[model samples]
Target: MSITAQLTDSVKLPNGAELVNGFAFEGRGDAARRALFHNGHELEVYDLYEVFSGERAPAVVFPVPWTGWDRGVDSVSPDATFAVFSGQRAVRAVGSDGKQLWEYRHGCWGPELGHPHTGDEQEVCRGLEHGSCRVSDDGRLVWAHVVHGADEYDWQEYWVVLDARDGHELARLPLGSAASGSHHVSHPDGLHMGLCIGMGQDGILLHWARWDGKSLTSWDVNEGLDRILMDVHNGLEGFLTVEHDGADLRLHALDGAVLAEGEPESGDDENPAGWDHCGGFVDTETIIASTVDSEEEPDRARHWILDARTLRVRGGISYPTGPIASYARPLGDGTWLTYDTRNGTLDRWTTATP
Candidate 1:
């Protein structure tokens, strides 16, 4: 069961736009098709199809207050009307017109504590520690992770949900763990959000939460296992995860049952190759993953197409356009993306023969 990969389109990033997440695509198909590019202070919203055709003009743009290095992760609303930034000190919502819509303050992610010197941006500038923010599918809520002052002397990590319209705090749950940074993976159900918190050498923590309009409920998943939650299956049947060390890849049901597991042979009897955290479900029944971390040279790295239902390796993706970067991101639309760092261009790929 082998599938071939072919390059379809390549678009150079517009006007020196340096992106944090490269490009964040919204939905699978044309019904709700959009992509967001954020580079610290500005966010540009583009139509996914237009981007494929080398369209350079963004449909909308939002200007943020803090610089890129001072922030954790930022996201834009599905409607492209508001952009939320998770900064070292607070979560801010900015409008498309470059105005501050609202802000929710929290304990600083930086080490500076206790005393209020001056509310200067440089106070927490260049801090390595941070959190992540994501807009809900409905555009009614904002899910965020932040450092909170439990009291004057103690600070705790908390996951909070905010009213997107006004930045009002609606619900919160204390994470009870140290975090270096985290990312939110939104479930297709719109009510559920999966959070993966990176705890550095302490390993990884994965949490799942649901916002059911009235209340927020959360549960810790992958307990005792150091797995990094990667992506939710497009059908919402199960999600993808790879071990923190990339030793094993697993697919789990919504209730946290491991449906399948895969440990690719590294060709070394002792050291098995592991999948990197860079891939995802390419479609309903297929997965595209990478093993770049296991390769000493980036040029020698390889990407594999796996059976989404069973985690079985099907074959390697053949690039007709020569070599791709070590990482490939599956867009869940039967296509994936790779970046050419040399020319700052993004190349889109799909199967040359189906």
Candidate 2:
């Protein structure tokens, strides 16, 4: 017996707006995700559904001061009062009225900005593509990475908690992280936030933080290992799912204890490329993964479902529409999302007993 996702829904984007992760920002409670369009001089956000359904005009449209394209929107507050934008040397909080609430400005995107990993006299800018900011589950705080002491020859990296109503730095923890850039995910617990930094060949860095009412505390789970932090399973408290060396998929506690591990099967007619990444989790117990090894489009993908708590294969999944990327997204419900970047559509799917 095997489990495979059956397509349930597909939503296309408005023209000019590419489908990017977190670009279509939506919270668990939100009725729809806000679709953003940033073309340098102007930044506009259409109610992802309002425009798609022809129910209303763009929810919010504003003129932007910057000319460079923003990588993506970091986060939209749960209350929909504000949105955060991130990119090279810029992190800004904008109000629902399309006015600047507050801004955090820094030097070039990376490197000569005194970044420990890439700072060189000649190195100029290193832009980030991730919308790395996250709002707490309670909607009281926003967690972000702000460049600290950036002017000195070597700058510091600080993960911070911000005032959601007004852009104010509340508390921060110093992480001597030397990565090219990073992305973030929220924990089920409102006060906890997780980070994954990519450093190319140097490997990945995983940082987890908890913002108590008074202060903030954080620690690294990398353990000097060469692995990439992949997904955060809020359903399983304190356990952060990760990918080691881009192959070994494992579940780890915040303290760096390995709870479960999944090894890539050798490539054959059954599993492609000797083994590939797992899809992390489906609900709290079901974890799905793909055997297709290529990051680029795979003509076909074979999925394996595993017991999230035991790291044992429970079943296999197959794609009817075609191959999906190694990453299969769990929708928190019984369903998950599958995508092909080349096709530019996010397909909602679910497991079917076959």
Candidate 3:
């Protein structure tokens, strides 16, 4: 049966704050918190905590360099001391005061890789294609997906792990995929991270990696599927993935076995409804997913609650308020976030008991 989504709490973003790739919830249990990068005149981080208890200001704020578009997909450390920007040509780390902590230069992700005649800071801001970066749970390591060389002849994309203190390349794996863009899904254990490389129509590449102190080991999980990797379980047991075409959602074990699959029933067989790439474990046994893209009208998009263990759709989540945006981000603590793109407000929601 369907459950109502009760409004619990909310926090308005700072003035002039424009979200980059929306906000993310990190940590688990009491240590859980939210992190978001807002790009306006410059990039800034808003690390928020205790939103449900009451309205809280950003616990930490870090300023980053470059425009939001040029930053590719950036991530801030859990402690909010630094932010790593996955750029068009480099993955850079910057301190709260905008000081450059470290930078790892790589091949350009720009479409016009051959047009680069001079090397300058602005040169890294010229492309629309790029990768993403994320900090480990402990904030000791930074995982990045970058093009491996500076020239066309040797250009290749790789998943690299770097020492967070300094930009020392610790371990790397050559990703044999032509990436239009990519993102990393941080495993709760801190040692393992999942990468989803989007190659457009060519299909998506899913890779799981583990860092065991000395080297980085990785393997392919989705051999021939176009799945977009989502969140990992709180216990590090398995993760979630939705197909690129929104065909279905699958729960994959740590070893890459499909435990269960769920495809919401479509009203019209001619236009089968599918889940959006956005969604995650709401808690240990439940999930919050949306089908906003399946609807032609923006307000008609809906979110659904599903059985995380079996990938079974429990029911659609009804908002006491009006319709939300296209995505529902779960915090893994039974609470999820819905953004109001119009007013820049993030509302926390919890499903009411039936």
Candidate 4:
């Protein structure tokens, strides 16, 4: 399958803060303008917020409560009515008006435990090195990798399922922790989700879960694995990953099976600086893979589209270079998005919708 997406629209971020990874679309049908954007440090939801559509100034902005010392599981609900903030110590559900709905005491950031690592306690747990949170599709449940920091040596991860409506505990399973903060990817199936953790020397851990009506079922498919997840396939359950510090891009199944694997084309004797470490599934069939600025090519990162089924390069797409990081964010309508931080603009690239 050859993928061709054309640039059709662009929007300037009103806050001027750079986007984190990508944007989130909430609500359904005509009301889907509510978009969730990450301004690096915090996730903000905007009313009338479809940045790709016609120009409509954000009516209001709701910022999540964040700790200067810790990273939280950050996202908004599908309806854009409620915001979920899974912080260092607790998870708080806030309303669009920026009022707290309820709070659940989950765990502590290890620095507060008075341990030492690469940095100070506060400095060590600076980014999302602990745990994170996400909401279900119907806005009924919340999934969390709740970390319980016991000591510098024994931090445990509680695979938690929560009631999104009332902020109550639904179920908790101790996924005997390796690293504290593992990033989670949501599935359209609602009952499914995946978590990927990258522990520097300890290796990578991949987890997949599904609610089987009675309880949550999980799979830690890290046996004999070396790469951390670079992206989740657009299908919601599989993955697109790179070997730890290596250049081989792999497509894998939820059960840890490598479906297809290869690296971006490069010249011989060329020590390519590796990928800009970005890209993702454009749809059920296409993966948008890109390279970061190499020492050899600092001007721009190369963008390549891949067939998710065959893991084959379909074609290459183009976008104006950016200052922060070059990336491709597929919008799932035979189109993808790119953020040119240098010019502070968001662009939508699409092929004729099939």
| Candidate maximizing lDDT | 1
RMSD for each of the candidates: 2.7, 5.1, 2.7, 4.9
Model 4 steric clash pairs: 6-350, 73-133, 130-181, 275-292, 276-291, 276-292
The local distance difference test score of model 1 is 0.78
Candidate 2 or 1, higher TM-score: 1
lDDT-wise, the better of 2 and 3 is 3
- Greater lDDT among 1 and 3 belongs to 1
The TM-score values for the models, in the order shown, are 0.91, 0.79, 0.90, 0.80
Please give the ranking of all candidate structures by TM-score, highest first, separated by commas. Answer: 1, 3, 4, 2
- In candidate 1, which residue ranges exceed 4 Å CA deviation? 14-23, 29-33, 113-115, 150-153, 294-296
Candidate 4, residues 231-282: lDDT per residue as tens digits?
5533455677777665678877777787898676643465564654556666
Q: Give the 10-residue window scoring lowest on summed lDDT in candidate 1.
A: 14-23
Q: Once model 2 is optimally superposed onto the true structure by TM-score, how far is the C-alpha of residue 147 displaced, in angstroms?
A: 1.9
The sequence of per-residue lDDT tens digits that candidate 3 reaches over residues 33-80 is 655645464554444455445545555555556554444677878877
- Cα lDDT tens digits, model 2, 180-210, are 6666776765667777766666677778888
Ranking by lDDT: 1, 3, 4, 2
What number of clashing residue pairs does each candidate have, in the order they appear? 0, 4, 1, 6
lDDT by candidate, in order shown = 0.78, 0.60, 0.76, 0.63
